[model samples]
Target: MIKTSRKGEWLEIIIPEEWDGTSVQDLFRTIWNAPKKLTHSLRMEKGVRINGQGADWTVSLNQNDRLDIRLFSEQDFGIQPSYHDIAILYEDDHLLVVNKPSNMDTHPNSPEETNTLANATAYHLLSQGEYRQVKHVHRLDRDTTGAVLFAKHSFIGSILDHMLEKREIKRTYLALVEGILKVKKGSITEPIGRDRHHATRRRVSPSGQKAVTYFEVLKTDHKQNLTLVKCFLETGRTHQIRVHFSHIGHPLAGDLLYGGKPTFSRQALHAVKLELTHPFTEEKIICHAPFLDKQNIFTGIDPYSI
Candidate 1:
């Protein structure tokens, strides 16, 4: 029941406990504050066990038996909400901006039918009784939370997609990094591509497409070596921030792909601000989301603290 993960805060386990099937949930409540569902927090999401084997909750528990239960800090099958129900930061006839949370895949995936922000936004549109299309302008990484845009119609969606292609849309992110960067601000220009064996992963490759990221170290703790930095995207690529930072040997905290530990369950990157021209209005629209304190922008630990 105890699985080790660098990205996890605690271990989740289920073993023999002196509680009956009917009262197991209550016992869980007494010992740990968790949600009602198990799959909710991939780790803390609980299952039934009897006699050191996986079973249904209908099985009874024996007295003086050893039971194991560990908590996956950020993932709790129903403990704390994994994501905010999409905070509508801005909305117009053509578009909507949402304050996204970490830990959620932007869209649905195989066997993991967890609710997604896209689905939630689509439902919101349906709630208004409007048949308008809610097309995602772009997607953020599953564990990277931040500002996201949706187009209410195909026309606007197409326009926004073009804007992204032409680099007309500007995105800014706030991230918590592991160490003090020597420079105050700089650009990371690199080519990135897929890792052949790890097809789901990416790596810095000269043969890959052009990618650029600009970053500024806003603050740092000499003691902790941890720095608070802001990043600007020149070319939006999958895992750009995580990859760029990792390529420089300072992956953002909790970003597993580039060697971040599960010190935090979610990547410490937030799309804090964005700028672009409205498709129809032709006016510059700017939106800013104050830093989400949840990601720990900068801990007082120095890079050497590790």
Candidate 2:
């Protein structure tokens, strides 16, 4: 495993045995997939070093070599900080995972919006004396509650974005739908596209992007005709889960937009867990968000137990 430490303004990384003889350029381009512009900036600004001295970008690395990169210099926290309470699930120098509450947008739609999760995250970072832009890795709907990942710096943020695109980050969700599925476990392989009739709705389209959702039924409330399901996504299409389940005649209990029953106020969906590989430290990271609603259909269900 790679070892990492935070200095005043630099991040110190110790090369591991497995990366022996890997060229610095290969590490940036192949391993991290850093943008060429950012790589040029790092080289021009002398932001990278080897053993406390300036680094030669083409030189091969050795095990235990000290590689230092200036990543966390104080900068403006781009978004306006909102001083509201937020539940942080996991945090480190490289990443943060926060338990987002219901009825909160992931980020602002306009500059005047301060009641967003990103604004609250900015406030949390400022409290720690770290000033960096709020960079969320993924997003949840306005009413969906769950663990959201954030990158503390742009370098790691870019790496995470690539990981998400490659589907290396596993996102698991817990949802309560209006009916018990005929099959206990199944996968939905459908293409989804924007709904022309509505501005913010998606539908399964024949010529749309490929979307896949895997699900396993966890429990069934036969009396209420509701089913609790654990869903995994292979693609991140807009409203993929909601649209897929709705297409199968089982809309989320409160997802009124897709013709669901008004069994609850908001959609009965929550991002229960996130699993990913740490970009720098090379460690497996798992974050879980417990059910956040007080009077939802999944009250008795324990998401962590799954």
| Index of the highest-TM-score prediction | 2
lDDT (Cα, tens digit) per residue for candidate 1, span 154-231: 444656777787788888888878878998999999998888889678889989989999999878867755677888
Candidate 1 ranges with C-alpha deviation above 4 Å: 1-84, 110-114, 291-306
Where is model 1 poorest over a 10-residue stretch in terms of lDDT?
72-81
Candidate 2 residue 285 C-alpha distance from true site, Å: 0.6
After best superposition, candidate 1 residue 212: deviation in angstroms? Answer: 0.7
What's the TM-score of each model vs. the native? Answer: 0.67, 0.98
**Model 2 spans > 4 angstroms off:** none
* Model 1 C-alpha lDDT versus the unseen true structure: 0.65
Q: Give me the candidate number with maximum lDDT.
A: 2
Encode model 2's per-residue lDDT on 1-306: one tens digit a residue.
Answer: 679999888999999998899988999999989888888999999999999989998999999999999998887888899887889988999889999989999999999999999999999999888899879999999988999999998888988999999999999999999887889999999999999999999999998999999999988989999999999999989888999999999999999999898889989999999999898888998888887777655788776876
